[model samples]
Target: MRLLHLGNVMMDLVLTVPALPERGGDVVATGSRSAPGGGFNVMAAAARQGLPVTYAGAHGSGPFGDRARAALREEGIDVLLAPRPERDTGFVVCLVDAEGERTFVTSPGAEATLRPTDLAQLRPEREDLVYLSGYGLLYEANRAALTAWVPQLDPAVTLIVDPGPLVRDIPADALQLLMARADWWSCNAREAALHTKIDDPAAAAGALRSRLKRGSALVRTGPDGCLLHHDGTLDVIPGFAVRPVDLNGAGDAHTGVFMAALAHGLAPAAAARRANAAAAMAVTVAGPATAPGADALDAFLRQSRPAPR
Candidate 1:
């Protein structure tokens, strides 16, 4: 089964600062780098697990777009849409403080627009895993196109939704439409709280999972790990503790690895286990695209296993 990503991929300008400055204050960054971020992190994480991935999102024509396109190609992910002319891809200015937390300021570009014809070009096969992000719903064009197209998907195809940080901003009707067809829902603590109005991650997972017709819900709880609700059972998958260098893309890493593992036939609980490991590993690194490959993930899991009694 292939993984199809119908989300936005954009450029990320990351600046490492000692701490985020207060409003009207100034602070110089200690380091900086630019790379493909946003949905790119999820796709890249899945690709590293040997998943055959396709990016069916809009790209732009300028340097940022060019770089994002190149990065996708280099990662062996197929880009289905040609770059939109005269427009650059959108970008996020990521400010990372000493605690590994990041705040983003985004500028939407070509990636924000989606036409009806763009949706027509997608043809998901049986058992194919299709991913949609809350970011996609932030734009009227993309939101309309995706929500209208979702309910029409074949039963054989699986839909995964990750209602991101902007979950609260998405229209209720659109959010309901997407969730109605979602077969898997993966999100973090804040996002879960926003969607379910439950402050506890495990309880939030249970509430969300109850709404699914035939699917599961995963609520990632940072250092405490994740809660997976599947087949009427809720399992708390413990996290791997580590000193986080940067928390950017950690949730995406968990989502991508979880989907990839599920597509490869692992049980929901097992998939959550691997996803937890992937998230832990991602935060230990300092970059946004730090998802581990299969070999690295395997080795990390092996070493993290408990010793024999």
Candidate 2:
């Protein structure tokens, strides 16, 4: 099965700073780098693992858009849409703190301008693994189009939704409808807490699953690995421990890798274990989306023992 990533290509300016600046204050970056980020990270993570991925979002014409498109080409990901001239490609200023945590300020660009017609060309197919980002679904320019098209997807398609950090910002009706149709849901601990209002990851997963008629809940809990809930049981998938230098796209990396594994018939618990290993490898590098390739990832897993049954 092929993975179809529905989102925008973005340029992430990752900066390592001792501390984030407050109002009327400034903190110089200790280190900085520009790379592919945002939803692009997710697609790259999957593609790096040799997953066939098609980007179903709009690319734009500008410095940011040019590089974004070029990066995808470099990663062997297919661009399924034409570039938009009206809006530029999106960019993010990601401030990674000493603890490897990141804060982002983003500008939604061409990614947000995806009209309903743009999605029509890439209709959902049976056995297709579709990735949907809440960041894109909530944008005003994309919301109506996405909402109108969500129910049209084939029931056989596996739709995974990651609400990102703005889970609370999406309208209740829209969020509910998407969750009902989504076959799987993945998000970080903070995002899970925000939407479910449950502090415990297991509880949060349970609450999140209550909305979906068919799907499992996967919550990435940083070094603690991820919590996977399916059929009323929660399993904690342990991850590797490495002192991270940057944590810009950790969740995206996990989502991509996990999707790749799932598309290949791996169970949720097993897929999450591999994803955890992939994400841990990503944070060890300066780039957020620098997950290991298929061979490298397999090697990493071989070095580690199998997830406990």
Candidate 3:
């Protein structure tokens, strides 16, 4: 089954700085680069693992949009929607600190202007995986369109929802709706706490899993890997050790590889194990699309020892 991502994929303007500047202060970046970010990371990660993927998001007719489309094509992902010639694609200004932590500021453009007509063109088949993100839900136009369309998806279709860093900012009703419909709800430790009000990752995962209708819950614990709760059992899928140079797309790598593994018929825990490896590999690189390809991932997994359970 193909993976259908209905999330926003925009340009990323990444700045490498020693530290974040103080209020009303400025800091010069040591280095910088631009790339297709946001949902592009996940799609790239999945495609690298041999998943046939499609991007059904808003793109614009400008430099950023051109780069995004080109990047997707380079990764072998299908672009399902045409560019909305009215405005340019949006971009995120990412500041990566010495400790590999990142902070972001967004200037949304065409990606925020999703319409009902765009949503109508999507046609997901049974067993096809559909992905949604909290970033999309944060925009009014995208939120309105997606909330109206998601519930109507075929029940046989698998829904993967990533609450993202802006999880707390999403409206409560919309959050509930997406969570209820998700076949796989993947989020990081902080997002799990925000969504469930439980500080412990395992406890938060348990609470999240209880809300799913017929799906599983995953709480990614950064370098410690992730907790996968399915079939009434919680499994701790361990992570590999690495000196992280950039942590921007680590979660996206984890989620992408996890979904790809599932698409390849791996069990939840087994899929998470591979995802853990992908995330570990992502952070060791210095960009937003650092996920490893299938052969590279296999090589990494073969060389690394599993973490003690």
- What are the candidates' C-alpha RMSDs? 2.1, 2.1, 1.5
Off by over 4 Å in 3: 18-26, 98-101
Which pairs clash inside model 1?
Answer: none
- Ranking 1 against 3 by lDDT, winner: 3
TM-score of each predicted structure versus truth:
0.94, 0.93, 0.95
The total of clashing pairs for model 3 equals 0
Q: Once superposed on the true structure, which residue ranges of model 1 sit more than 4 Å away at CA?
A: 18-27, 98-101, 306-309
Where does candidate 1 have its weakest 10-residue lDDT segment? 300-309
Residue-wise C-alpha lDDT for candidate 2, range 203-245, written one tens digit per residue: 9998988878888889988878999888889888887867786
Q: Rank all candidate structures by their lDDT, best first, as comma-separated numbers.
A: 3, 1, 2
Top candidate when judged by TM-score against the true structure: 3
- Using lDDT as the measure, which candidate wins? 3
Instruction: Check candidate 2 and list the clashing pairs.
Output: none
lDDT of each: 0.90, 0.85, 0.92
